[model samples]
Target: MNQIELKSLLADRSPETPAGRIVRTLSERGSMSAAQLARLTGLAKSTVSTALSELKRSNMVVETGSESAGSVGRPATTLTLNPEAGTCIGILIGQSEIQVIVADVSHQILSDATAVIEPDYSPARGVEVVRELIDAAYANQWRSPDALLGVGIAVGGPVSPITGEVMRGGIPNWAGVNLHEMFGPMFDAPIFADNESNCSAIAEMTWGAAQGFEDFVLYTLDLGVGGAIVSGGRVLRGIAGGAGEFGHVVIDPDGPLCRCGNRGCLEVYASFREPLAAAERHVGHALRIADVVRLALDGDETCRRLIRQAGEAGGRGLGLIGSVFNPALVVVSGRLASAGALLMDPLAESFERFSLVKGRDMPDFARTLLRPSAFVDNGACMGAVGLVLRHHGQPLNLPH
Candidate 1:
């Protein structure tokens, strides 16, 4: 395989060539019919056909499978980049866990693994653990990391845009650590990093519920209430990396203190942390967010009531987000989202009650659609892989 040519085309953000556009589009959207590619790339059918022919001839693109063409005609041929072209790594440095995903250019994940770490682990220690995980992943796979194109890091919190540092308020020990500096020497390929929520938004937009949406909001109603905003097919990472911190939004001045060192933050009220504790106390055992959701789904009244209350509380935060962005779609994610309608129904009602743009006032098409995430737990990690595929040409930069 011409790894050099494929790598060059992947890095060429501004394609200027039909083949380049096709490769980039495939990398971002995974497998699709040639007609779908032509529509997505906005190229003439003849132009796409000609470029795809050359790409296939060069062993860059390959036919994956066939899918029926709706209720008419024969099955359309599905196509994707050859899986042997090259690989990309996506690492998630989360609050108390680290995840690694090795994937090929065709969007197939080769390996996925996670390791739990202490909450306040040092950045250097975190790096050591991540390196170990990556090494183990490749040891099991036949593919060589020699053709690695790039690496994407998804941090649990916001990463500074200008300084490239992990900002305060996300990971307690990660604040101020430069992500690019920490991971640059570990790999020869370019490094891309972003907030985990933003990565999740990319995952949703690329392969999950937010697919076909260029604009939407991802409200994560997890242990902590956080979110990400996507505008024009790009995540909006605010100036100081605090753009989508819905959790830290202060709703009251005299309430309890927040982990971000703020008082009366929406997280204090809306996050599932307190409710999870209440459920655990009621059951006399610790319960994961998912476990609580499952219990609720199984008709445990205490768990069900806790989730409903959490959803009602979470909706106020969504209402705040809705008032500001007025997004067309809000993909509710995180572990709590697994509760489905037990969370969404009340959340939607609360959103309509609190948001400035009332759902009753808008037309059916104009009203915002609230949808659950496709992946309850690993959306952000999958998005970490997308970070490399979607934004490989750009390299992280910080002041010297």
Candidate 2:
């Protein structure tokens, strides 16, 4: 295989190159028909056909069976990038765990691994965790790490798209760390970095709950209440990477303190940190957020109450987002979201109660819709791979 040719095609950023665009799109969006590619890439049908023919001839693209086009007598042939062409790595430096997923050009996951760590782990420790995870993932696999096209990083907090410098919203000690400066020398390929919530939104759009929706909001009710806004098929990362930081939105001046050092922030009220602690206290031992959710599902009233109260509080925060964006859909993400209707029912009720656009006042189609995330645990990690494939937020030579 010509690793250099695949790398060159992926590295070409020029808008005039349809073949590069086709490869990137297939890598990002997975299998789709030729017409879908033309519409998505804004290229002419003839141009797409020509580019696809060349890609197929070069063995960079391959057929992935066919799907009915609804109205067609002949089935539309679905196409995807050849899995052997290359692979991508998605790294999630999360609050309590570091995860890595290796996926091929066809979006097939080759290996995945996660290592639990302290919330306040050092950046050096994070790098070590990543190295170990990557090593384990590539072991015994048929693919070679040398053909890695790129790496995508999903951090717990917001990171500057241009500088790759992490902002205040992540783990306590991780603030002020430069992602590019730290991770750039570790690999031979490009690196894409973004906050975990933004990555989760990309996962939703690319492969999960928000599929087919161009506009939506991802409301995370985890240890820290965070979210991402997807407008017109793009995540709205604000100046300084603070956009969609719903947790930092101050709801009261005299309320409890937040991790972001704000008083009465929505996160102070909506975050699952306190509830998880309470559940741990109730259980008389340490428990993960998923454990609490499982207990609630298994008819434990104490855990149920904790999750319910969290949902109500998180719903209030979701109401704040609804007033601003009035988004078409809200994909409730994070571990707390795993509670299913046990969490969503109350959260939706609170959102309906607090939102200016009352559900009763509008028609069903006109009102906002809320959907739980499809990924219970690894969405952000998967979306990290999406960053490399989509070429979204790829860091330049970011100097400290």
Q: Whose lDDT is greatest here? A: 1
Which predicted model would earn the best TM-score?
1
Compose the digit string of candidate 1's lDDT tens values, residues 1-400: 6888988898887898999999999988999999999999999999999999999999999999999999999999999999999899999898899999999989999999999999999999999999999999999999998979888888987787776788874787887898888888899887888888999999999999999999999998887888899998989888877888889889998999988788999999998988999999999998899899999999999999999998899888899999999999999998988899999999999999999999999899999999999987778888888988997325674223
- The per-residue C-alpha lDDT of model 2 at residue 214 equals 88
Cα RMSD of all models vs. native, in order, equals: 1.8, 2.5
Clash count list over all predictions: 0, 0
Which clashing pairs does model 1 show? none
True-vs-predicted CA distance for residue 27, candidate 1, Å: 0.7
Please give me the total number of clashing residue pairs in predicted model 2: 0
lDDT of each: 0.89, 0.88
Give the Cα-based TM-score of candidate 1 against the true structure. 0.96
In candidate 2, what are the lDDT values of residues 247-268, reduced to their tens digit? 8899999988776777999989
Per-prediction TM-score to the true structure, in the order listed: 0.96, 0.91
